[model samples]
Structures are given as C-alpha cells and as structure tokens.
Target: MILNFFDQFCIPNLLGVPLIILALFFPLMTWFTTNRLIQNRYSTVQSSFLIYITKQMMLPINITGHKWANTLITLMLMLMLLNTLGLLPYTFTPTTQLSMNMALAMPAWLMTVLTGLRNQPTASLGHLLPEGTPILLIPMLILIETASLLIRPIALGVRLTANLTAGHLLIQLTSTAVLALMNTMTATAMMTLVVLILLSCLEMAVALIQAYVFVLLLTLYLQENI
Candidate 1:
C-alpha cells in the first residue's frame, strides 16, 4: 500500500492538498502571537494601527485575534517549504503537477471570497466594479468584474504547474543529451550523473524562486482582493 501511494505521488500530483490543509491556520499562530508580544513591549504607529484594526474588526464579536491574516501567511510559508523540499535530487516535485497546484490555489481563491464576505458584505461585489463607475457602465462593469474574478484562480494554478512541469522536463531532456553525446558508454554514464546533479541544484534554486513568486503574487492579490 505504501509503495503504491509513493509510486503514484512520486511525480507530484495530489500531495499538496494535505500540506495546504496542515498549513491552513499556521500563519495566525505564528504571526499574531508575535505581533501581540511586540506591541506590548513597544507601542509604535504600526503597532497601534494593527491594534486599532483588530479592535474595529472585533467590536461586534470581540475577535481580538488576527487569526485570518496569520493563517494565510502560514499557509504561504508551508507551500514554499514543501515545494522547495520537493526539488531535492531524488525527491518528487509536487508543485510540478497540475492537480497539486490547483488544490493549493483553490484555498487562495476561497480566501478572497471569505475576506469580502467577512469584511464588506454590501461593497464586496463592488470590488470587481471599481470605484466611481458611471451609471451607464455599471452593468457592463459588473459583468466584466464577475468574469475576471472567476478566472483569477485558474490562471494562478496554471501558471505554477506549467512553470514547474516545464522546468523539470527541460532538465530531464538536457541530462538525456549529455548521455547521447558520449562515444564511450562509461564516459556517458559519468556525464549523465554529473548533469543530473547539476540539474538537481538548478531545480533547487528554481524551487525557491517559484515559491517566492507564488507567495508574493498571493499577497498582492489578497491586499487588493480582500
């Protein structure tokens, strides 16, 4: 059973789901606690603003915790670490698979919905419409906004999966080339090994870069969409 699952997931398909779930609320615990402690010790403008926002948000329900934001940051970090780890020489790179990337991106898309729902019920749909849209254009604006919002997550998923998949396939092809060029089978073996190692290192760098890009884009989207 274990071997079967490993064989199935060794190429990066569905593994990101468990990781995303585990990381779902990690940011809140890591971020809010630290922020609270820092504010108690040093009350700065930033700290005050954070506290004020917390208070305003919690006035009705008293949710003094910055749990939502924390959870998101934590989720981002978890994805980054998981993806980077997968870039190891002998390991499977999960993010290289489309199914895995879609699972991860889905939560981000859901968060945008929840953010609007929780914070701005009346004005939520207006996010797509922008401010000061003319009366004549309001209906058209809403339609365009609806289409754009629906498409954001699909683009996010495809971008990540395609990049990872292409990178891995490229490295594999290059390693194959190193093997094909050899006059002696023995020398080809050695060159193939070297190319594999070099590609492994390259993959590691790409892993880090991809993770950073994913999270950075995620944060930017949240900043606006939320």
Candidate 2:
C-alpha cells in the first residue's frame, strides 16, 4: 500500500530510458515568446510578470550581486513552470524528487558561499562566530555555526521536496476517496469532490510559493555574502 502511494513519484520510463529529461524540458514549451513587434496578450503578460518579479528580486540585492539577477529569475520561472505543470494529469514533477531539488539547491548555495568567500573572506568567515562570545563556548559555537552553514542546501532541498510531496499525497488520497465513494455514497462523494477541488487550488498556490521561496533563500544567501 505504501509503495503504491509513492509509485507516482517514480521516474517514468519509455523503452528503458527515463522520461524525466522530457519532463524537465516540457515546461519550456509553455513559455511565451515575444518575437513579434506587436506582442500578443500572452507575450505581454509574460513580459510584465518578468519585469515585476525582476524588480522585486533585485530590490534587495546589491550592485555586485545584480549579475545574478538573470540566473535567479530564470531559475524561479523554470521551477514555477515545472511545479505548476506537474499538477496536470499524466505529468511528472522533477522538483518533487530529492535528488533534483538538491542538485538545484547545492549549486545556488555554493555559488553564494563562494561569492562571499571570494569577495569578502573575513566577513564570510566571521559568520561562523558571533561577536562577544564567552571564551569557553567559542569553540562549541564555531562548530555549531559551521554545521548550520553546511546544512543550508540540505534544508532548502528537503523543504521544497517535503511540501510538494505531502501536497501531492493529500490530493491523491482525497481523489481516491472521492472515486471510491461515488457509487455507494453520492452525497459524501460530492463533498469529497469539493474538498479535492479546494486542495487542487491550494496545491497550485503552494507550487508557485515553494519555487519563489527556493529562489528567495538563494537571494538572501547572496545578500549575506555580497
């Protein structure tokens, strides 16, 4: 039963080759292109959203970190599209995979750390120790801080994976219950259907929010370094 519940998360295959690669790139197809001089509604909305999100994300970053603006925005959009599209029937969500999430998290976190180390070594290293520390507790504090620093990427990945996974499981369970009750308990099934709809909407919001959070954390890490 447990295996059945988790089976949906497994990487889909075609002729023994993983379809996750296709899943990863599928979102790109949904992106709006602005090739025409007179933009259509889709292109206009896409450009406006990009501009707004870019402004918001750049507001907190310093000039030195502005170079990361494009990378961060592109990542956020990719994640948002992947997560949103995953909610569709017969689609896979790469973000729900821990390995994929960690792959995204680790590089972003490492880049921030490296930026800090390269640009401001003393300040970055200073983060490992708080000011006015007791002499005896200094060593212990340094160890704790070091542990926390190293755990950032893991935390980022786990948070995204857990949230999306839990939401997907809930939606699945609710949907299954609705289907099971439709014949025997019409009224109850209707109620369950309504709940399922609500859950779907909430999940969509979570999908976007989690992607934003992932990038926001990366931005904060960069801010600390820069």
Candidate 3:
C-alpha cells in the first residue's frame, strides 16, 4: 500500500509528464526572455516603464543574448525545479535515476556534435581534435576531445542526479529510521531532521548551481560553434 501510493502519484510525477512539461517550458521561457531582452536593447522609450526605468526584462524573463543557449534554459530550469521540489516531504527525485540523467546528457551531447558540425563541414574534424595537435597523437587527441565534450553533459547530468538523489535518499532513510524507532527510543531523530534540513538547503544551492553550470557550458558550446 505504501508502495502503491508512491507508484500511483509520486512515481508517475517523479518519472513522467511533469518533467517533460518543465523541460519544454524552460527552453521556451528562456527563448522568449532572451528574445525580449534583445529587442529591448533596440526598443524606444515608449516601452514598459520598468524597461525604461529599471532596464530589466523582469522575472521569468531573462537576458543573455539571442542565442540557442538561451533556449537551453529549459534544461537548466527543469533540473533546478525538479531538484528543489524533491526536497519537499514525500516527493521522489527523478534525477536519482541514471536514465533521467542520461536523457539530459543525450541532448547536450547531440547539441555539442551538431553545433560543431554546423560551424564548418570540412573543419568538423578540427573540433574533435584542435587545430595544432600532433599527428602522432591525433587519434589520442580525438579520444580526449570526445571525452571532454561528451563529459560536459554527462557531468552535468550526474551532478544534478547524484546531488538530488543522494540528498533525498538520505532523508528517506533517516525519516524511516526515526519513524520505526519513535516508540522504542531516540535522541538522533532531531539530528537527522537537522541534517535533512541542511541537505535541503544544500539541494537548493545545487539546483541553482547546476542550472548555471549547464547554461555556462551551453554558452561555451555556442561560442565554439559561432
């Protein structure tokens, strides 16, 4: 029954549609925000008062050039919110699953490759192995480059998944222990709760940090392509 409740609601949400929706929403939001900001740069004084006075695009609206990375804000925000939401009681973190992390990594990996290829046809090889590396080491360099490029998204995914998954799992274990021992004995339940709270705070930071790291790496990828 315990598992049944979890499977019905938390599992579906933790594993399914909500994540997809968030994933889509963040990029779209990022695109609109970035585009609005870009247009604002060329706007007239007759635009919104905040635009005139504060020169800020406002919340849920962000600016960082009109590029594809802005669109990738979707991934960042999704990971962030998902990670954060998991910190709440009774919520499962999807990131805890490697499959979910892989989903995130796969896109980034493909984007990196596509970006490199789009930059130049014949020179696509150069991206895999920088311009001036030695011929004797070219194959090795290729492997290294591939690893470095591929690892960005992999690391991003793992960092988020592990951080969130680990935090939540720890909370779950401690909470279960506390409940089981409530009638028997305990002084460490409070300590566990304190640690859980601290981990929750850490999770929030991880969410934001992961988002920033993901975006920054994406921007770097774009910079390389452009």
Q: Which candidate gets the maximum lDDT versus the true structure?
A: 2
**What digit string (tens of lDDT, one per residue) describes model 2 on residues 1-226?**
3438777787778887777667666545654443557778977897899999888888878888889989999999889977876686556787899999999999989999999999999999999999999999999999999999999999999999999999999998998899889999999999999999999999999999999899988999899999
**lDDT tens string, model 1, 163-188?**
66666776666666666666567677
Q: After superposition on all CA atoms, how large is the RMSD of candidate 2? A: 2.3
For each candidate, the alpha-carbon lDDT, in order, equals: 0.64, 0.88, 0.61
Which window of 10 residues has the lowest lDDT sum in candidate 1? 1-10
- Arranged by TM-score with the best first, the candidates are 2, 3, 1
Q: What tens digits encode model 3's per-residue C-alpha lDDT throughout 28-51?
A: 696666656555544444255323
**Model 2: residues >4 Å from true position, as ranges?**
1-3, 13-36
Better by TM-score, candidate 3 or 1: 3
For model 3, state the Cα shift of residue 195 in Å: 2.4
- Once fitted onto the true fold, the runs of candidate 3 whose alpha carbons sit more than 4 angstroms away are 1-65, 122-124, 184-186
Residue-level error in angstroms, candidate 3, position 144: 3.0
lDDT of 3: 0.61
Residue 198 miss distance in model 3 (angstroms):
1.8
Which residue pairs in candidate 2 have backbone atoms (N, alpha carbon, C) closer than 3 angstroms, thus clashing?
A: none
Q: Candidate 2 versus the native: TM-score?
A: 0.91
Model 1 residue pairs with clashes:
27-70, 27-74, 28-70, 28-71
Task: Judging by TM-score, tell me the better candidate of 2 and 3.
Answer: 2
